[model samples]
Target: MLTPLQKTTIRATVPALQAHGDTITRTFYARLFAAHPELLNVFNPANQQTGQQARSLAASVLAYAEHIDRPGLLAPMVQRIAHKHVSLDVQPQQYRVVGQHLLDAIAEVLGEAATPDILSAWAAAYDELAALMIDTERDLYHTGTEQPGGWSGFTPLRVTRLTPESSVITSLTLERPGGEALPPYQAGQYVSVKVKVPGDDHWHIRQYSLSAAPNGQQYRIAVKREDGGVVSTHLHDRVREGDDLLVHVPAGDFTLRAGTRPLVLLSGGVGVTPLLAMLHAALTDTPQRPVTFIHAAHNRAAHAFGPEVRALAAQHPQLRTLVFYTDVQDTDQLGLPSHQAGFITAATLKPALPLDADYYFCGPTGFMATVEGILDELGVPVTRRFTETFGPSQQFILPAAALAAPI
Candidate 1:
């Protein structure tokens, strides 16, 4: 709880904070690393250099200040960050260092404008926010203890299979060392895979969503070889069965919200990975729930899980599947061709999709942006639309109040 004066000061300072957030966060990270270089082991250098981590931190801080009077509003965002922190192994004492650096950065950036009242308010706010995160992370850490087959950080697992699905996509089967039980994960959650590439001093971490419901014996993840991308190229060419790998426990907030509402699942390119898991869950767990699963691929050579999807749709009476090809011949004669030859837009969505159904989407930024706009135009409630973006996220423009920054 904040006093009225404190809240006022914090609110008054938000414009400056938002516009200069990246600047402040960068300064804080520099100072922290200069003082405690060991912290580098916990942060992804690529993410830091790309400005993703700092921007995410800035958004979280600004959101917390906005919702100070109603802390519950921050729950979803906090939980997501908690999972990231756990994967990164952020310790309790690190929060204090972070807070100090944050305050110092603010003072340095604001100079004379940062009066006593404003500084005090921000200091209190940072402490409260940091405490909230530490407590939430601790609770999650404890929860993992009581949960069956749970582990704190990434554990060394061995790859059992690297079955190819297409030219670019392959299915990976991983099992715990010594055949220990694996933790169950929700359909759309993703796990981080850490690997060290040649000539790299640090490890690379990337997230891949599960491609199937828990199969009891092995966990399945689908990877799309990114040709020139570091982790993807290694996984495609060098990684193989019997290779030891490190994988963090599954974590994400994009899982299906339990409901009886008619459901529509959409994906493009490799985005189909998570939705495939959801579709499998729907078949086994909620067979009667109305579902329209849509997938888009660049061409036949790029399509993944085509045979499996066809089989699932054939077996389940309630499930409807559609594929759109951006570069397939109009008269092409594939035996199991249920595909269209265009993009998925509002007009295309209307015919096959129920008007009042829950929508879930995952894909490249362009695909999601187009789909979200179509859904909004169709008047779908924000709550009914669930989406996730993999890899680096899209940038967010600072709010209008952020005009105070000269740059």
Candidate 2:
């Protein structure tokens, strides 16, 4: 436990810390890579180029300082980052080195403002925080290691089936190369897929959330073709079943919160993947919990898992499903009340949502931002708004090098 004085000191210094957090994180990563280039195998260079890794590091530091007094208060944030760390193959010993770099970066960035007292307090706080993280993550790493096909880092797996869901989407089933069973993962977590694209200098790694409940029979991932994007386009154009692909262990904290509160699942297009798992878990594990699903797709053809979602809704009395067809034939349109003609707006959703409900949403950034803004305007508490950003590249930002690099 931190002393009262220490707590007060941390609380006051947080703004200072937040102001320089990104700078320190930036410096820390630069120093870390300079000292330990081998760690690059665990981190995605493209994400680094985009500054996502820096923001991730910065968010952790800020969250730690913000919740220094009551460390337990940071449980959810800790769980989220721990899963990311595990996927990155972050080890306990790595924390000490990271701590050293972080402290050094802070002192360098803050200069005279980082007094011995300030430095000491932060060091102690980081040590305490890191200990908690290490303790929490060690169990996860152990549980993962003990699993049949799981290992400390990336391993080779063969794609078993590549079933195309639509013109732009495909569902893949993968298994360990030796027929070993892989580690079981929670519903909405993601796994890192590393592929060596032809004519590329380095391997391209991306994350895709698991699309189904873990049946222990086969792990599944749904990937969408990105015509304008590099890797996704390659996966769609060239990737095939029976081909070997490298994958990191499953990790993420976007799993469903077990509670009795009614769930309002809002998804748009491919955003349905993670929520599909959540919906599946809700149907099987917590069937009594009321769930209302609202999905928006470009058209019927672009709608992924339409039949399965309908089947689940049909089977569960507590489930209410609504779909919005952004594109449909005028002649065949049902013109149903639940079937909205276009996008899902606050007005369209008002009838389906309970006055008091816990909402979970997943979609493109624009869609999510729009819904979040609408929900906020409608007086939804921030705590009740749960969301997940699908696909890789963490939170968005442009790295210094990328800014300097000529187009």
Candidate 1 per-residue C-alpha lDDT over 1-407 given as tens digits, one digit per residue, 9 for 90 to 100: 56889988888878997888888777877888888776763565666777867776777777777766666656767777787676655679988888888898888888898898888998888888888889988886766655788887678889999888877999899998799888888899887888888886767777888898886557888888874577878888889899988988777767977777888999999999999999888778877798899998887788899889888988988888888888886454444546777788878778888767989999977898889899977888776778886644443222333323333
RMSD, candidate 1, Å: 5.0
Tell me each candidate's TM-score.
0.88, 0.82
Give the lDDT of residue 130 in candidate 2: 86
Clashing residue pairs, candidate 1? none
**Residue 360 of model 2, lDDT score:** 88
Q: Please provide, for model 2 over 131-189, each residue's C-alpha lDDT reduced to its tens digit, 9 standing for 90 to 100.
A: 88888899888877877766877788888999887657898898877787777888778
Question: Where does the lowest 10-residue lDDT sum fall in candidate 1?
Answer: 396-405
lDDT of candidate 1? Answer: 0.79
Best by TM-score: 1
Displacement of residue 129 (Cα, Å) in model 2 is: 1.9
* Residue pairs in collision within model 2: none
